[model samples]
Target: KSQEFLPPDEALEDPAQIAPGDWTLEQRRPWTGYAPPYAPDLNALETQVARFRRGDSLLVVGAFEPQEEEQPETDTRRQSMNPRIVDVRSRRNESRGERQARSNPFGRIQEEPVPFLPEEPEKTAPVQSGLFLIDTETGTHHEVLGEGPRGAFQLLVPNGRYIIGVEAFSPDDKRAWRDRHGLWQDPLVLGLAAVSDLLILKGGGNLPESLDEALPTAMPVTRIRTGESFKAAWELYGLRIGESASVRIGVDRGGEGFIRRLGQFLRVLEPDAPVVMTYEDTGPDVLGTVFRAVELNLPDLEPGEYTLTVEIELSGREPMVIARPIVIVP
Candidate 1:
């Protein structure tokens, strides 16, 4: 009982003529790649299904169920068949990606435009305080400086550089408040300074007239210390009619031989005007009262309002004139 043997390679190559024991290569194509031999038009079939109104006969080709009972419309029977429904499909957002690509020409993601913020402005420099000037000729260099209220600076030249002096503009070293209250301290050391476009002054060195040219544009600087010196610490002293009131008006630095020289009386004004109060020219008056502290005693003055103005001249500076009024009824 010997069987006829077949070779393996020939059996695999020619599987159609081989027995059932041969392994055949199964080559299958997808259903979507091929079409049915006789398929119905889907669009025409949908149209025919939608035209089924009231009564329409559907011809079942093979093993198809036929329903003679028609679907109900507006039925109010005991068993209400209309069930509540909600659509969860994202049909509205389906074309969002296509719309974004159309607006962005460079294939960039469409984004909201950002707002711009403005930058801060720059600040301006402050105006200068005072101008400085200096002069030199034939090796004789002299510095002439003038300072006071802004209008009182034109007495100085404004075109050159001068060694600026620092000074304090407060009088009454005690910080008292008054109109004539400002003093210039020791000369400050500002090595070498420069000024430009200053005004040229005219006439003599009277501060008011000399500084009138640079009136509105000049800055105030301290040059001279002019104020009331605390004469005797201001103790409440009274002057009786015939008691010979002795008042000191000069600054004597703690009696350390620092005596501010008082040469002659500047002027004598009754109510501000220079009034003539005649006394013996050489010696004291009949009452032993000499004009020392710009002082005078009234032997007989009717008793009313009297203003005493005394002008005292400083050595190498301007004369100081002080005027104060007193009301006498008795």
Candidate 2:
């Protein structure tokens, strides 16, 4: 058998025609005497060229012509490769059934393995009524629950002093704290310890310098010359039965004369109660201006209608009251 020889330059010019498995060349070859050269070992051929046994076809590029097929509509919102529409409504409906399967009276979910990539979640954490932050140092690791990804972000740290600091760098490209520490040679430290049952949290996403130092006492309530009052409303859910409902009142805008204390008769008649109420406070700067919450439980009444009443009190002034009726079926 004889083979045709072509230089590497000629092979490069029309490599398609000379390349093995060329459909056009194979068709032209005399079928009677022609046999394919010894087949190259695929393992070796694959290293230099792709392991394609089929003939190569040329993709013709015509003149710059308009596309015959209309370009598919591009939806920017649908760009996500793995798109999913989550209907929280259906999940909420099945949530009850899922919860029944997982939870018992002992405050523990059933020992079932978590599902793999569940489309609709059946259970979620019950929404709480107040801000409650678990103390990280207290060795208390409370599991956060809720449907949203950021559900656990609102936890309130226990009451205590906390050092508050913000990230900063000196203009000279050095850590300000580190430079100061090097100069003093004394260990630079920020004190952070929680008091018993009380947690102090640093606000504005800042670390503290000394947890031992209390936050500057808010300006006294007597600083404001003119005492003012304002009406506020809140919706509350999940009031355990027979729990004391004591709500602190505060003004949203007043400078100093805010914070009135008032609450409904506390007593829960049934399990899981919700209510809406209105309260009033003297201006800002009072104790009630910033945090105004109430706690109440009406035990005598069966799990049903609840009319929440708010009585706002001001310093050296007559008490102004607002009443809002709330109903809790379950």
Candidate 3:
């Protein structure tokens, strides 16, 4: 019998069809493209036998030289390539108006033209001439009137600290005149016994029996908690005879340079958290001893010191201003 030897390529096994423990490479077939499929059972058994030969348990394979876990690498440099996310955090702190101005493709927001209301003819006063005689000693007043062109008038009364006021009425029958502040208009004060001085009245004028001697008093709490309701009591002297009185209460962050108007600040910082105010009469009579109280609904404000400003608007005079310092704590 003749013995025949096969070539190395013919004797080599295909890696795809070989089992892990069954496949081996010889020196003659060192370059063979032969790799066996992975087998966990075969590897575990072989590891057990090796450990037993070394007088160790099979579980020691994981303890002595544990297989390292393969972790996929993440490329953070590639993730930071997006443009919008590059400086996203910094842009968040910008104000809404600033953001709107910056985001606008055109320079500014477009505004629409406002329509004008037609002007009506001015009404002249029906009662052209009126005389007011006030007795300073008794705080009493008497009035004399004539409906005609303004003319010189004379009144002979007991001479003792007396004041006389002349007034012209508007042709419009409106009972009340509003001041510049949209509140009840106060009468013009004319000094006593002056012949040369002329008194010019814009609207209906009255000779008050007694001047309003009461000054306004405001008592505001110094500190308030967030989301709490507080009362600001104001004592006003002499009459609540007006359509309505308005009180405006505003808050500002302390030490923020110049303080801004409440509406302006609310339009920027807390658009939804508006400056709230409520008005009520605490007076005994409609035309005497006016006592007013206002309520303020505080929002969730940051813990800090703040300045509170109160503006009281009565029959059309300049609004009275009151300011108080307050604190909000956690």
Candidate 4:
């Protein structure tokens, strides 16, 4: 009955030529050499439909046919199913120094590591509202009360060097001292005077003896004085960020000798006095007194203290170095 449903040409077609859809058992019977000994089982139709749903379509002619038996399993004890494991902990634990020593057994032993010490915090005096005097030589501190109007204060002590600083507390609890600019006096050397009005404090004694002799013994009455002395002074502008900050170095007496030796060369040092900016001729300015001023360009610098040094070279003598300290703020 199923063969009648197919066209006569399809029924009579060679089994290979027939479409898989029409290649029923009756059509494949001529190509297959074997025949079923039992009658067709109608109950197996459900099983065949389930197999087809499971992707086992009956289009393949001998797909379900029995295959030849596989060869017996071989026993090969010499072969390994997994890779061999290695314990490299000992080798990895070896230190670099040990490895180097192993490579060169006759080499000298490496130096022992140095112990590190934590940095100590800086100690600053607490801020207070009063007149405070610090003995620069002995580090002794003294505070005194104010006297008359304007909160005026006075201190009378034995002749010694002192650092006078005023401490004021801000609303935010921040303490600031009067150490900025030239407010703090240098070492004051007091001596006995016959008259109460006579008081003299030495200055510029720290200058190099050779450079000091080059200075004029007497001041010139005229505005313009001439000598071989070299004098450098630093003028500091504002230290705030984005502000005009610069250092003006005035070379008065020895302009010609300075130009001939240094040629406007200058060096900038860090607060620690280490040379950061090497010697570079900033070019010469023969205008009045041959003053050479360098703009600090404070915008690019971090907020901190810095030192600027000017080295004045001499033909047959060691260079005389002068340094000025400046601060920057954000």
Q: Rate the local accuracy (lDDT) of all candidates.
A: 0.21, 0.22, 0.32, 0.25
Residue 256, candidate 1: C-alpha displacement in angstroms: 37
lDDT (Cα, tens digit) per residue for candidate 3, span 26-75: 22222222111111011111100000011110100000101122333434
TM-score of 1: 0.16
C-alpha TM-score for every candidate: 0.16, 0.17, 0.27, 0.20
lDDT of 2: 0.22
lDDT of 2 at 290: 26
Best by lDDT: 3
Instruction: Tell me the lDDT of model 3 at 54.
Output: 11
Clashing pairs in 4: none
Q: Could you tell which candidate, 2 or 3, scores higher by lDDT?
A: 3
lDDT per residue as tens, model 1, 294-325: 22334344444443333333233343443323
Indicate which candidate wins on TM-score.
Answer: 3
| RMSD, candidate 3, Å | 42.8
Error of 2 at 196 (Å): 32
**Each prediction's RMSD to truth:** 52.4, 32.7, 42.8, 45.0
Q: Candidate 3 or 4, higher TM-score?
A: 3
Q: Show model 3 residue runs off by greater than 4 Å.
A: 1-221, 255-274, 278-284
